[model samples]
Target chain A: MIFGLVFWLLVIYFVARGFSSRRRRGYRWLQRELPSWEQKNIINAEQGDAILSLYKLKRIEPRRKMDMVKVLTLIGAIFVGVGVIFFVASNWQRIPAPIKTILIMSVTIFTLYMGYLFSYQKEGFVYLGKSLLLLASLFWGGTIALIGQIYNIPTSQNWFIMLLWAFPIVPIAIFFDNAYVHILASALFLIWNFLYTVNNSVANYYYPIIIFLFMLPTARKLLISRRINIIGLLVASLYCCFYKYEWLSLLVSVGLLIYYLIQREEFVYLYASSLSFIFWTITFFTVRKIHPNFYFFIPIEIILYLTYKDKIRENLIMCLVGLLVWLNLSIYSFCLAFGYKFNVINFIVMQSLAGMVIYIIGIISKNREYVFSEIYKVFGYLVTFVCTYLLSFQAMIELRAQVGLNNVYLAVCSFLIGIMALLVTNEARKGYFENKAVRLELFALASALLVNLILLASPSVLTCTLAANAVLVIFAIINIFLGVELKMSSIFTAGTVIFALFIITRYIDVGWKLKEKSLFFIVGGLIISSLGIFLEKQRRKVIERMKQNE
Target chain B: MNKKIIFFFIAVLWVIVVAAMIISKQSILRKGKAVLLETLPVDPRDLLRGDYVILRYKISTLDLDQVKSEKPYYKTGEVIYVRLEPRDKFWEATAVEVKRSADSGIYIRGKVGYCYRKELGVIYGIESYFVPEGEGREIERNIRREKSSVNVEAVVDSKGNALIKKVYIDKNS
Candidate 1:
């Protein structure tokens, strides 16, 4: 109860803070910049007057007032729906089976009717009606569960109940053109499919195909949201994963890719296609083990690049990353197929060389219109840093074994890679990369290389591993601090994940002891909380400084 | 509007589907022959389905010695029919058939679970009997204390599909 209270309080606080911050920021921008914009001739006097009038008009818009009302209604509807569910569940045993079923069915049908009436008849209450419709769908599911309980049906019949609930909602969603209902129906359908597969212990190869066909008519009629398509693709992908059917993966990938190609304007299609392609490739490599077909991906990549060259400016970097992964896998397979022994150092060297070649090509081409070249350049620098780190470890291992030519060769390669990385960092700092964040990352890489070199010279493997772990922990802390200063959510998330990894690894290594583990957890929690407080303070200062600069 | 018509049609169809399911099950209960199978009490509670007992019957695991089939090998997941004959107070499997026979007798259909050495595991569908919430625990305690037996009264159709009618504890209704 206390946890729930605290959670709600935190949610309320954050929501209030968000609204206040947005209002303050808007007010500040207007106060600080409106007169300047007028003076600078960005806006004529008449345009400025129009803008101010429009802004005022927006504040009292009836549509906005209606939106607030709709939100409140939706919340109230959800609460009432939940209350109904609980009421039914609690009084289930006391109520006769026939009356219970009738009550639930009547309630569901009534909600649906009311929703339809409001949506069709009442203006400015469309959202409220839609929310009611969604509630009706939810209640339909509740009705199914209640019936199941009343009839004493086995849990295995859950799939059938879900199917019955989902089929009706699909038509409702399509007719209403409600995205929420579409999403809910899609989710229920997927769950039904999953439950059916589990209970039957059968692959159900035609399940995805049937679902896709069922959705097509509705999707065409409603112009269904991209979310539904993505969900469908996810369901298909999940089925492929469970069934380990290469043909299904191929079918899904090819189907999505064709659909995306046809609907080239929609980024969601592209996203789904790219995800399915990756999954298909992974499945091909691991499940099928058909290494000879790896070469086929080269022509496919070339075809994709050439066909989409005009639009490459938008998604080239992502496509190139996919290609790079495919190429690396192909290379690995080729080496294995031959009599060559698998060597991590050799693979890294080859991959880094490929990265450099791509980078050099990008530079020589001077494709200023596209940012693809710039991405290639950054990829080159990243690959060089990673390869150098690996080389340093290899050189250290070789040196420890004996003072040999291989050790000297590895050390020389590491030094060259490090020099190349530094030069790339310099080039990036010279404004070749556009993003200022790359400079910080490049400097970190340089320092990491130096630290790696020093740590490699240590005598024992344990010492090397420990030093690496400590460096990782320190880097994670630095990332968190930098994220706070820069206001980069991705960097902050990475730092949090790395810190979690460190804790997990330490726990695994130490195993479990009651008192000791508890103490460890307490100390860790305190450290993290303190760090968060410090970061929060720093964030405020940074934001203030940024505002002042602006 | 066309959409409303379609929506109403779908709603009616959905109701028909659900109604058909209940009616079909009810018909099976009303028309099918009833038989009692002795049950061995196992787990007393299901996490999601409230109070239930995992009941094992004598026919759940069959011995190869009782095999009346000409085929030497039976694959898993293949449907097999077991002809039941009254043995003492409860029915026991007398013969196994890979295909349904013209001779109408008490039979139960099950899927082959596994064939190992001399024992074949079968899954009959009527494996669980759910009681009211908290009643399962009391039934389990009584069975353990008095060394009592539980029998499931199931109605089996001509197609060998069986549904649990009721459960009798210590020969009580």
Candidate 2:
């Protein structure tokens, strides 16, 4: 009931907000622009006058009024449909089987008839008709359930029945051009497919084949949105993952990538496809234990770079990052596959070598305007930071015993990397590099190195962990102060998130002694509250200073 | 006008399909022979089907000796016909066959749930008996307290498919 109330409230709020905002904006635009258009001779004086008079004559346009009516009718239809379902469920056993069947059939026919009648009679009632049709579809599903119960059909048969019911909706959705119906049909088919696969305990190789043969054609004919297609494909991919169908998942991911690449203008699809492709590739590797090959990504990156040559700078940076990740993974895979005794020292050395090479390339690329060198520079800095962290971690682990030559070597390498990063930042500030992001990257790298040094100096694991966390907390505080000084909201938000992470780690690390836990929480709460107040005050001061300067 | 007529025809067809499903089931129940099987109770709730107890019977698990099938092996999900004979208070499996026998006395169709060595687990479609909301727990409690078993009155058609008629919970308790 609470959930229903909340859902209805949200619906009402959004509808009211949408209509009011649209109307207000429409009127405001006409008022502000009509006179200017007339003066600019974009519109004639007569046309302008006619437009203004037409706007004033109608309080709301006939079309908009009809939209309002349709919205209300749709809402009413949904409520009635739900009421009918509840009425049937509550009084199900009381009714005779024949009577129950007849009643459900009657209701289904009545709603479907009314839906058609409303749709045929007037354009304004189309939404009302669509709502009724949706309800009718739901009633059809309910009828299947009713029959299943009446016949005491096996639970496994339910999916097949649903599949049959959903089959008709595809035609309905396409013929009517109703997105809601399309969504409903897609969801039903996916659900039936999922249940059918699970209940039968069968491998779902047929799912993709069915989708490609039937669903894809229907989706194309219906002109269903990419969102629905993406969802269906993702669900299919999930099933493939469950069955360990690596090739199928790879195909789906590659298909999605190609689909998005063809429409590379839409960033949403690009990002979504990238994420899904990465996820599928990682999962496929983990499941199949395939030897990682950087060569596979090279052709794809080259294709992307060539295809998106107009946006060379951004695409090049993306390709570079992809290549770097590929290189790292390939190295790891090679070490594993060759059965090399891969120690931390070797890992750090490889990473540092790659980082330095990339940093040099970035420094050279900085002179060119073909791409943003900041991406490569930041990537290099990140690689160095990771290598330093690993070395320091290993050194800390070995600190309990006598420090070996390997540990000493790791520490020296980390210190030298940190110095290199600092020198690079100094060079960047001297106008050799124009990217401010590179400076920020170096600052972060310097902080990481400082923390790593602290960890290396600590004797015990507990002390090292605690000291590292404390340094992070201190870094967050420094970041917060710096953000306030510069009045940068992103920096402030980052600091706040890092501070929260520190608190969470502390909570997890500390033992669950009641007194200690309580004290810790209480102290933490007080400190956070105090810091919040102080930040708010600083924010106000910063705003005042900006206002004065303006 | 043409669209409305088509929609009306489709709607009528849908109604007929639904009606036919129920009518066919009801016809079988009316024409089939009735038998009572003692039920072993287990409570479960379905979201759409309301509260219910999963009913298990003595015939659910068939011993290799009781099964009179010519087939050497039975895999899961394969349907087998079990011929029941009235014994004591309820019917027990007299014979099991892969196909329906022509001289059927009282047969119940079941799917092979799993096979473990010599024992084969069978599941009848009429395993769940739905009750009103909040009544499943009460029925479970009643069955537990009475120490008397619930007997399900079922009707089996010529096809060996059984439909549950009613559940009598401890009439003598």
The top-ranked prediction according to DockQ is 2
User: Which parts of model 2 are misplaced by more than 4 Å?
Assistant: A1-66, A91-94, A121-124, A155-157, A203-229, A247-272, A282-440, A446-489, A492-518, A533-550, B1-5, B12-37, B59-124, B132-137, B153-170
Where does candidate 1 stray beyond 4 Å?
A1-68, A79-99, A121-128, A150-152, A205-207, A214-225, A290-370, A377-550, B40-58, B63-78, B94-97, B112-119, B136-149, B171-173
lDDT of 1 by residue, A433-540 (tens): 554454455445445544445443555556555555555566567666666657765566556655665655465445444468878777767766776676566656
Docking quality category of candidate 2 according to DockQ thresholds: acceptable
Which residue pairs come into collision in candidate 1? none
lDDT of 2 by residue, A113-191 (tens): 7777776776767788888877777676666666666565655555766676676666556555556667777777777
Say which docking band candidate 1 falls in: acceptable
- Residue A275 lDDT in model 1? 51
Q: In model 1, how large is the Cα lDDT of residue A17?
A: 56
TM-score of chain A of each: 0.58, 0.62
